[model samples]
Target: MRYFIIPALGLISLNTYANVIQYFTGISYANPAELFKIKQTELIIGGTGFHTVGKFEGSVLNFNTGQYGEGSAYTRTTSLLPYGRIAKRFNEKTVFAVDVTQPFHSNLNWDEQAFTRYAATQTYLTDIDISPRLSYSLSKQWYVGAGINLNFLQNNETNWALPINPTASANMVNRTTGFGTGYDLGIYHVFNQSNFLGLVYYSAIRQNTSGTSMLANRINPNLQFNFSLPATTVLSYVHLFNEKWLTNLQVFVSEWDVNQYVRFINTSAPPPLNPDFTFTMRFRKSAAFVAAIRHQYTQKTGLTLIGVIDHGPEKDEFRPLNFPSDTQYFLALAGDYRVNENTTIELLYGYGYEKTFMNNHVQVNGQNLPFTTGKVHLSANVVDLRLKIQA
Candidate 1:
């Protein structure tokens, strides 16, 4: 599972009339050939091997609401992700692979007196994903693959505030969980021994989440949020020039229009909330470029330097509150070592810088609220280790 921590206090109470936030959790890349190249295996194996991997990510948020009615909120989250994969060659023309990964984990807390009297705290557990893929070699230079994905999700929320008097306080808690499934397809073509092109398509996955909400003085009934996982298309290319230079390019497009509504059950006669809530999320897209060079000073060791750029998509009003929409840039470096024929290790370090703009309005409980419009900056560092064995 992946864990995210957001500090959203100070920014909520600031004097800002525009606020916009968007987030994307799936942004990891792995190359099997690179791993195999570092660990030369000769166990007469016709299938792929398995290994363990982990990741960590963190971020911060700040905002101000304004004068007598200003409220501030801050949050932070952390998550540990563990996963494994297996691959096999059924024949010279067919290959099968299965991978299980978890990339969603979160810790969020928000406090603001301008909108409500209480401070809200939420802990969300995103669904886990299990995928199995099958590939067919149409020719020596072309291949196609398809797969299925299953998901599981859970969440909990709590609110704290005072009743009629500021001296007395109360608490409310809510929790829910659900499951769903989806599919994916991919095609690739290789040219020479150093260049390749590939494309992947992901189908939309829908989750019908059900949960309960409880207040200090009342039972808020059951609530359901119909979450529609957007469909994505990715086109990628990789090139290797000699043994020292390499480049990778990828373009991603997602259909956010399918994310249409949030259905609440057992609240009030008319829902008692924002009635003008219309689904307006249209399209979200991005492009990424990576260029790296490796220098080998010895037969067993080498150093690689990489740089990447991510161009974010246009602003959308229907984006969820769980993700912050922003564009980012990354710089990374790593070292690879070959530990004989069956073992290898790689160490990597990277930093990301992000920027976002907030100029949208939101309506809650028949009230129009103004938020702060500015730029949010984020910095991140990452490390990864892998162990491979051939049998």
Candidate 2:
């Protein structure tokens, strides 16, 4: 029931969506289940995304006044990712396809002189995914899908304002790239000509990363570490009310609990020079719900409406904040026009808002730890343009 202007990223590589406060959980034009009825070879190319501005207000302990103060973080950013898909039918029962997308993304930055500066002054996370897959008809009403993954992940965090002493400050940073392989499996079943169901799963991938860690603003030690990307499952359903109306619903489940901390260490460095840096990012299991309704008003053009609700993983008590996130709602509109028998073009525009509640603590030498709770305002809009061609 909650509706607002939150940006829906380009949905193929995305709404195929957002990461960080979210991980690709939004209404999309491309779902793997879209191949269910394609009898011929097809290609889809598109671009999606927009810009965001935010204001951060939080509780902070003031040393001189011995009272809590508010507002320390601010950010403005723009994000746009790519998407493409190619599906070719080998037989009546088998279809081969390749999808190129950026599955997950997160970019949240904090100013250098903020009260919440120690945890991270900068944070970014995203990945590129290429999957080649096959969907085969098991029967007149059932289809099965399998695929292989080539994934590349990138992560960066810069920790600043370490309270080494009253006279000085320190900085720490860890930036790395992870590459690995995984698998995708899915099943699709249809009850009739107008209705069907789909389920797909993506396995967790291991990132063996090599990068440098900046410790205490001095030593830059080369380090290595291994981290895991969370596995995900999606269930989708579609039904046509009549010749002119249709609806699609999807439930996305993510195993975000599998991720904890990425610890980096230098094997060859001396004890004094050994810098063991750990990036803490912990989460609980989460899910998102989405729906889309399409109405064809003319022979050459159609319109669709989309809605989504995503529950974030961070909850209860004090946890080091990795990204500001909470329950979010989104609404989007898309219109499509057929250029010819072989081509179709679609455009989507959307917007949304996020009100965040956070409980966080900072490391200090004092006996009493001050935990802060506050709100984050994320303002952004979404726009996407796509073209699909068939033979």
Candidate 3:
């Protein structure tokens, strides 16, 4: 069929849907079951046809600290994320889509540097995103969609210290990347075919950075900081009984109290800390629940099973550099094979578990750090492959 719709739009255009929330904080009830079976109309062709989806993931993070260092440490990771998408259907009542992915990657690293030497021993964070969407269907139940989000960010940090006397020895590097734009809105409703409801809103993404500071050129170079991306809301629901069985629920709210303070324009500043340090932070709202089951072990072959529950984000907004918050659980298995009636092949596997909380602080440069309070455990395993064609 048109070469299986050009590899199913090049695999849903390497779709990353914001990593379902930047690395699964939760949400992705299989994305409305692939947008309701690809907006069928017999898979609409002339009405508009284009699709692509791609995904690759690997993760591991473990840390056990009775007081930091000399205890436990493990952080191994791998990622090869990609996405590209373009969809069109304008006659039967408009439907447009545009996609791009590479949602976050700052080059994570750390095989040595056992703890602290001066903060960062190695750091890298990356991201790239572009999305354009339009959906309208004020009839058969109701629908609405709006999108425009562009983002590109990079962050880097390096450290090395050895000042016992040698002229206050030094070696510290910090680099930050930039580019940002945001706005996203979504609404979906369908009280028939089975049941569905969705609501999404995301806004608040700002990046403006310039770097340089080998300890500020030996102790006072020029440095700047401005990185913010906290404003989100999502509510979802889905239900399908007969035809196979599926259920999902999601909720997320974030404002992070506007994530106050990170500014350091013009360099030199580190003594006025404590605006309650932003209420110490410990959860700003996140909830998830999912269930899936589909079987059609006939015609061609099909099977799907998924289960998840994630509720994370708390513990003083923990930031051991960045990206940390645990309370996750997962189990997934997917399969689909159809070498005829067009073409189809898909497989997926998943397993995850997480729980983290740590605290121990004292810094004004006086250094007494031994951060890490309680439980900290994480495990993840995922594999996905896809090939779909129909034209």
Per lDDT, the best of the predicted structures is 2
Count of clashes, each model: 38, 10, 26
CA displacement after TM-score superposition, residue 235 of candidate 2 (Å): 0.9
Tell me how far the alpha carbon of residue 47 in candidate 1 is from the true structure, in angstroms, after superposition: 22
TM-score of each: 0.70, 0.84, 0.30
Off by over 4 Å in 3: 1-136, 150-171, 175-179, 182-192, 195-208, 216-239, 242-245, 248-391
Model 3 over residues 92-183: C-alpha lDDT tens digits? 65666655555444333333444433222344555666776667666767777777778876553423222223223233455556788987
Q: Give the top-scoring candidate (TM-score).
A: 2
Global Cα lDDT for candidate 3: 0.47
Model 1 ranges with Cα > 4 A deviation: 1-73, 103-105, 110-123, 156-174, 217-221, 264-283, 286-298, 311-322, 364-367, 371-375
Residue 213 in model 2: shift from native, Å?
A: 2.1
In candidate 1, residue 375 scores what lDDT?
34
State in Å the error of residue 185, model 3.
8.4
Which candidate order results from sorting by lDDT in descending order?
A: 2, 3, 1
Candidates 1 and 2 compared: the better one by TM-score is 2
